[model samples]
Target chain A: MDERLLEILEDIQPEVDFETCTTLIDDHYLDSLSIISLVAELEEEFDITIPTVEIIPDNFNSAEKMWEMITRLSEED
Target chain B: MFSIVTYFSVEALLLLLVTALLYACLPQKLRRWVLLLASYIFFYSISGKLLAYLLFSTLSVHHIGLWLADVQNECAAQTKGLARDERKALNAVYQKKQRKIMGFACFIHIGLLVLLKYTPFFSENINTLLKLAGSSFKLQIPKYLIPIGISFYTLQAVAYLFDVYRKKIPADRNLMRLALFMSFFPQLMEGPICRYSDTAVALYDAPKMRYDNFVLGSQRILFGLMKKLVIADRLNLLIQNVYAEPNKYDGFIIALSAVGYTFQLYADFSGTMDLVIGAAQMFGITLPENFKRPFFSATISEFWKRWHITLGTWFKDYIFFPVSMSKPMKKLTTQARKKLGNHYGPLIAGAVSLFCVWICNGLWHGAGWNYIFFGMYHFALILGGNIAEPVVIKITQKLHINRASFPYRCIQIARTFILVCFGELFFRAEGLKSGIKMFCKIFTDFTFASLKSGSLFKCGMDRQDYIIIIVSAILLFVIGILQEKGIQIRNSIAKKNIAVQFAVYYALILFIIIFGAYGAGYVPLDPIYAGF
Candidate 1:
């Protein structure tokens, strides 16, 4: 899941190193536009809805966090 | 019964001191009451009968929050143990109901703000249209005594309601907590636009005022005072003159005033934030910061993120993401991405939402065409940056430029500053037309004759005044650099001896007293953001 998530993130912003790097939002690696693209891709790839309420930095700051959120949200779904 | 014009005023300081004293002496339960009472007193002192508007907003937000919560609770109870399809059906029904309530809540809260703040602007536009249509009818524009902090607190009210509807936070049952959150005196005037999750519980807890907190809070307040009195107010002399009679000066002077107005705004607004956060700190409550050395930003979008940070977050959360992530926009993003590739795909929808954000951002500042133009100006800048990002990246890479290198970042920062100063020019201009004329004069009538003849000092700032402003600016810049580098000056000072702390405090006081723009011949700038 982490690998898949990294793929999606890199697809959205290839310049960023999604594995080791956190602070994606904090460091401006993934801005609002990136978030928009990432959200749409994550929903389609993972078959889970990404609600706006969960669009905070903590959830998308890293690939690991993104995977955690995806798994948790998928289970909830 | 006395009125206080700003947090910088002696009356406000006295009020804060007296309240802090009362809060410290009182029992824990009574401290919250003291805060509530002091908040009401501060509101009444400013707007008098208009306090009713704030009271009405508080009560309505409290009631609507609970109403939405009740629906959510009911939906949860019914949805339990149901089949997935049936549960989804019930959830949709409840969401629709809650959405209606949220819409109505926004109508009551944001509607009041629009009516009170924008009625005259709307009426004048309509009258112009009526005239343009060759009609004799003129709309009778009514004057409104707008409540103080209506703009700041209305956003708070709407944010609270939205949070409740979204289930980000449980609906706060205690009206007193909600009331305090809504009307917290320090932030009620000009906000960092705090969230319920940020300060509500901390305020209700009303921690005992420790000596360190008191001293630290006082130090912060004094720092804010220096920023306001020494810099923002001093710059006011030039800014007010150039902006008022923009036609009186050449573009060089106009450009200087634009830069002056931008710095004045920063000092004024950020200084007020310092006072607000400091006052909250005295009560052992912390408010979110509204600024992060915005001038250091390398892009207009980055500038917005760093400046008036809370308001930007509010628009991002409430306006930007919601609009962009809406069903149609999401679908637009999905479809566009497949066709246009990753970056430009989401940008189409992002631009749509960005436009909405900037329009609200502009009008949220005030109800004027210039404010709208200010919003659109940034919107265009941000959107243009977005469009040019790929090209810039390609060019920089081809040119062997390290985008993250110091010299390149410096150029970016300088470029962003010039753009921001122009935006502030429009923001501070009398109206849209004046802003445009001043902007045009920058190119058409550009010259340094005023500086060559030494007549530049005569407008409102003198040679001595210019020197003082320059020295103060350098001081602020050093402090900003330390802060950006993660040096906590206050905390570092706190670790020092008591004598050192007091010396720092007294130096700030004496600085304001000596070079401050208060005595005769200096008309202090009014609280700029408070009007917004």
Candidate 2:
């Protein structure tokens, strides 16, 4: 799950080092379109639905935050 | 009401000088009110009785903002000791009240915009429908006296309300600061819509004026004027002649106008931004920029990201994200993903949100069918791009072509440029039917003679005029290329000796005075986006 999150991050925006990166949206490394594509890719790979509300910067600003959200949501499912 | 066309008009120049002097003389704490007063005075000069609209926006946002904040505070206070589920219930109740306040405020602002700007268009369409149905009743189309900068101000107001509701920033307690954000005179004409969080601090801080800012601002204004006077205004003559009777012209002429209009629009809008941004800079405000040499974009999506950058950001924050996250959209995503594979699933929601965005974007420009078509056209291109991404990547990898190669990048830029030109053609055309006809003529009315027969020369410009335009355009293109490479030309030039600086300024001034298509018979176009 951790590797997958980093994979999506670096694949979409190569400059972002998910380990060190925070404020992805603030810096515009993850623009709205990139978010859309990321959501699609994540939903497919993890087989967990990431809805629009879950797409906010708080969840996706870092690989750790993203992993946390995905794990929690996976448990809910 | 002072149309920005009068950047050199005596009254405007005098007003600006007076405002600057007043700002400089005022004490630190009192300077904000000076700006607020200056904004209202400027608004009064242009909008007259319509100054009431600015006051109304200020008052409503001010009242509703406080109301939202109060509810939030009260909810927090009342729910502090409650059990978990009870606290959740209390928070939900507070959320509903906050939503109501936001909704009411949005309704008044958006309703005013729709009633003033769109009623006539909707009335005219309804009357057409009535006539088709053989009904004798026909509604009268209203001739609305739309306040200057209403669209821009309304959007700013909307952004502020959304931000407050989302708790992105605490709702501003000060009414005058909120008012100043909405009516900042420089941006009122055509906006790089200033969000409260983005610009309000700079505006209220009343930073001490620095000579560097003034010089840089003046240089930016000079570049802006050069673009407007030398290129956009000059091209206006040829565009008017070609578009007035487009069918009379051939394919090459229409194609030329398409390309010309694109250049003309960039020069006009970016010129306006430079002028306004420079004006803000003089006050040490550092307003956000609206353009970023969008022609260099390698994709339509990227072009939008660069062009009218604030509007794109505003929509993304206010419309696109909210819509994508709404319950119905989430459901649509799930269903689409299940039915069509995961690849296409999330795009379903994004597309639906983008659809709403483009439609609003089109309608926001004006109550015109062509503008609406322009919006949908872009929406189509962007959505098309999204769907084609994987296939493109696959093909590129299979062919072993470097996606980041220079030649490949140029091809993409050219392709996006042509697509944008076609979109701009519709945007600028007189009507939907005309835009369609003009587009059709591009394919049907072939003319190799337009290139060789010297017909292009006779349109509305002589040889000297064309030469001046070409030279100025080349200069702008070079600047654009350098800027794209992250070169700071203005800062670089500012480092040079006083003699070099004066020489550069003097040359631009001379070029503008000698060859600019204005001053005698030329009609200064109202800044194009001002109508919106």
Candidate 3:
């Protein structure tokens, strides 16, 4: 819902486009290593430390999914 | 000769039965010792006097490591809370002691390795030098039979010393456990190259066997057998014939043989890794994964990460990173960037690491010139990739091409295959000159007509055999694709009903029995990585 989050999603869409990338897992766009790198980048940019378990495929599937997960993690903190 | 008989078919069966019995009946503390004894027996059976050499090298390293650890502990205690001058003096003493110990360990292990593996090469060079010096003496290089797994164990021993030096893990105090870890029968001959920190705990504190571990490990063994007997051995025929006479074949045929060798190497090496790791798993021990669908890797660096992972990681940790991160290389890169630009820093570092990794890889494979060129070939490709990364990104941006798109990925995959094929051509070549000749002939005499005329089949394979090879390769690729897509094949099988499980097991065993390239008339091919 936030414009800043939307901008981040747009930036990642090309590399992590699950809708168009059938070669990847159905829900998650990035592989294990890619997800780790993405999380590091996001933490630096968004100023939030994503919990280790929250980095799994189920929660970080799409832009909307990642936003929901991040919002919850931040709220919990 | 007696040892040879112990390794024969019936003996192997008996050994397996005995091992199973021991696993069932032996007390927890005694099982490891029994396994260690059995491992030595297996080695002695094959290696004879060479077994003594292995034992000597293992024991020497074990004692030296223990001694070094004690010295380091003493130095650390003396230096604690000391003034800067006193601390510096203590640290210098510690460094000197560490260096002396490490140097002796390295000399003994590397000296043994060079003597066993490179004596012939060294002897020839020495003779040539003698002749140049006008010596009247004519010396012949004596043939020495290398002990089985000498190279593997030597590398493991060296890694153990390095680990101790770094204080990553304390030097293992138990000599038997150290010996067992180094010479564990199943992995000793051809290793995934076990590290002290990674496999030490498992070898020392083996957990009680669970039903799940047994079932999964069994499945892994079956898969390994399928890959080895059904695919690699079959491909060996074609590779050997083509490489034996590279002059006879055109580039296309040579290229095909190279591709065949790649598949054969992967199947043979990874298959054995599965068998070794799986065997360890049966004792509820988890070994480091050796392969992760290597061919699916999009980049050369990625391929190294996925293929023979332990070996790659070893070289990276012990060789490449150290060389690349050395003060001299770092200063050179920093100076170059300040003078020239940041673009060249990565380029220089990449080149250094690639060169180190490749040369080591080639030498690790063998002392052969072909192996060296194989290493150089990959070094060039990986270095080229690193250099072109920025340019590629720039070009794609300018062209408005989505680089991560499926079509783009396909192109990268195809390019990777071509790169791999070229490397294998050199790797499978009989010698360096043959590799060059075969590579040159590929461009000059390439023709599609050879395929039509059945020249491909002329390489000691029947039409039926070729058909089987193709089918099995397709099956392998299918399984690889499924795995790449994150399908857990073993878990999927586990979730299936019991009838299906039994059916799958039976099918695998039956296929191996009938279609496997072993038994009557078939020469048993040694595991490919065993020589290394």
Pairs that clash in candidate 3: B3-B45, B251-B442
Give TM-scores for every candidate, taking all chains together and pairing residue i with residue i: 0.97, 0.91, 0.84
Against the true structure, whose lDDT is highest?
1
Q: Can you rank all candidates by TM-score, best first?
A: 1, 2, 3
Best by DockQ: 1
- Cα lDDT tens digits, model 3, B1-532, are 3444322245653665577568657787887877788788878877777789888988888898898899889987888888866776677788788988888888888888887787786687688889999997766886778898887888889888887886766888898889888888777777778888777777766566667877888788888888888888877777877899888778888888888888888888888887777777777777889899888777887888898898887887677655655546555654554464444543575477668888878887888878888898888887787678779999999999998899998888878877888888887778889888988888888898877898777776778888888998889889999999999998788678999998999999998888888776666566667767
Q: Return the top candidate by TM-score.
A: 1
Two-chain DockQ for each candidate model? 0.68, 0.20, 0.04
The C-alpha RMSD in Å for every predicted model, in order, reads: 1.5, 3.7, 7.8
Query: In CAPRI terms, where does candidate 2 land?
Result: incorrect
Better of 1 and 2 by TM-score: 1
Better of 2 and 3 by TM-score: 2
Error of 3 at B121 (Å): 1.4
The 10-residue segment with the lowest total lDDT in model 2 chain B: B1-10
What lDDT score goes with residue B237 in model 1? 88
**lDDT, each prediction:** 0.92, 0.84, 0.75
Ranking according to DockQ, highest score first: 1, 2, 3
lDDT of 3 at B314: 82
